[model samples]
Target: MNEIKKVLITEEQLKARNAELGRQITEDFKGKDLLAICILRGSYIFFSDLTREIELPLEVAFMHAASYFDGTESSGKVNLPDQNMLSVEGKDVLLVEDIVDSGRTLAALKATLLKKGVNSLHIVTLLDKPDRRVVDIDVDYSGFVVPDEFVVGYGLDYDQRFRNLKYVGILKEEVYQ
Candidate 1:
């Protein structure tokens, strides 16, 4: 079992940052057709909080795509289980994610959506780790820039535990190693 090593982001901090992001998004796409897509499982918490902040008429969708499975690092291959569930054609798409690391999953998803002919595409991530990116990806809106460490809580997980923690934290080294 892994204990939380340190509190990375407090609950109050998350709220403030997400609120800012929501306001910015609302202003940026004031009258545009916006379809916010949540990269599922990991992004559920962030997605819910963010969508509530945006004061605009928009639609919400979830895509269960993942590149990590019961491990500390990514598996390097993104899997989209419900690929045909939602259609994003001709919509201004905003991809909401829990974190952006390695950039493999987000890059693949962005390419897939672009091929579907989205009118515009933007990315919003609750956390970003620029040191781990393997592919070039642009994050339009980001909450925090984290160090190169395995973090958990706030929808990010390891074997799917600790997600209920209100704040973001660093996982104990013993847990993953």
Candidate 2:
């Protein structure tokens, strides 16, 4: 992966697609009392832009859950927050994520929410990596479906290195070495 190709998704491309996603979300939850549940760390940037684009009245909540501890791999165990700031019981909950790789996190979160008596549950992800899927999860709205390669930037990362990259890129394997 040392041979770097050009940026896969430019900053302009990301902005345009994000705006489109925002418009769709705004239209879908027009009159309903929308509550956006954003996954922490990774999805914070995407959530910020998407929620702002949403014109309808809504509330925002955050949950910190992560499992990746090694290089390009997830621990496959999700840790829920001890003190959740937002209550979604009997409310329309839309879970927003930065990317869907293994999908274990979202699937687990959705199941927990359903068990807690959430009235409605929806999922929105900025990127989808179908090739790496280990658990079944449906994305109601997605901005892009990425290839099976290891990617970084636009909020995705490797040991938290490339989150600040404006454009998504296929990382050089040597970087990981």
Candidate 3:
């Protein structure tokens, strides 16, 4: 059996932090029509809790993107998910993602949305890895800034697994060994 190395953000902690993020968002968008655009597969969990915590009227849209295909390297090309059909012509849009590892995905997506005619655009990533950032991307809101270790759970993944784990953890070496 593989022993879990350590747990970073437990489920309870995640809930608390998520609520805090939602409160900040609620306060910010109190008088505006906000669009919560979640990047699929990863940010879905974060997105769901985040949107629910907000007390204001909000619309949501989802998009799937893949900058990392295998191992720990980014493909540098993003396959945008199909749920980007929400009208952002003049709406305040917040691009929500699970993690920003290399900053490539968020950077590309942000530029793409800007070109799509969003009235205002901002980014909020649940986790950030600035040490591995390849581009100078800045997230407007970040839940945590983590080291460059491969993390799983709380929406992050490993070979598309472990996403359901309630806490975020650095996979034990034996798991990879």
Best by lDDT: 1
lDDT of 2 by residue, 134-168 (tens): 99888999989988777788787888877888888
Residue 79 in model 3: shift from native, Å?
A: 2.1
- Per-candidate clashes come to 0, 0, 0
C-alpha positional error of residue 72 in candidate 3 after TM-score superposition, expressed in Å: 2.3
Question: After superposing candidate 1, which stretches have Cα over 4 Å from the reference?
Answer: none
State the displacement of the C-alpha of residue 57, model 2, in Å, after optimal TM-score superposition.
1.1
List model 1 lDDT by residue over 1-177, tens digit each.
Answer: 249999999999999999999999999999899999999899999999999999999999999999987578899989988767779989999999999999999999998899898999999999999999999999999999999999999998889898888999999888888
TM-score of 2: 0.92
Alpha-carbon lDDT, every model: 0.93, 0.83, 0.82
Model 3, 1-177: lDDT tens digits are 144577877889889888998899888778887898999898888888878888899888888888988766778877766636656888899889999988888887888788878888878888888898889997888888888777889787778888888888888766655
Choose the strongest candidate by TM-score.
Answer: 1
Error of 2 at 150 (Å): 1.4
Worst 10 residues of 2 by lDDT: 1-10
User: Each model's TM-score, in the order given?
Assistant: 0.97, 0.92, 0.92
- In model 1, which range of ten residues has the least summed lDDT? 80-89
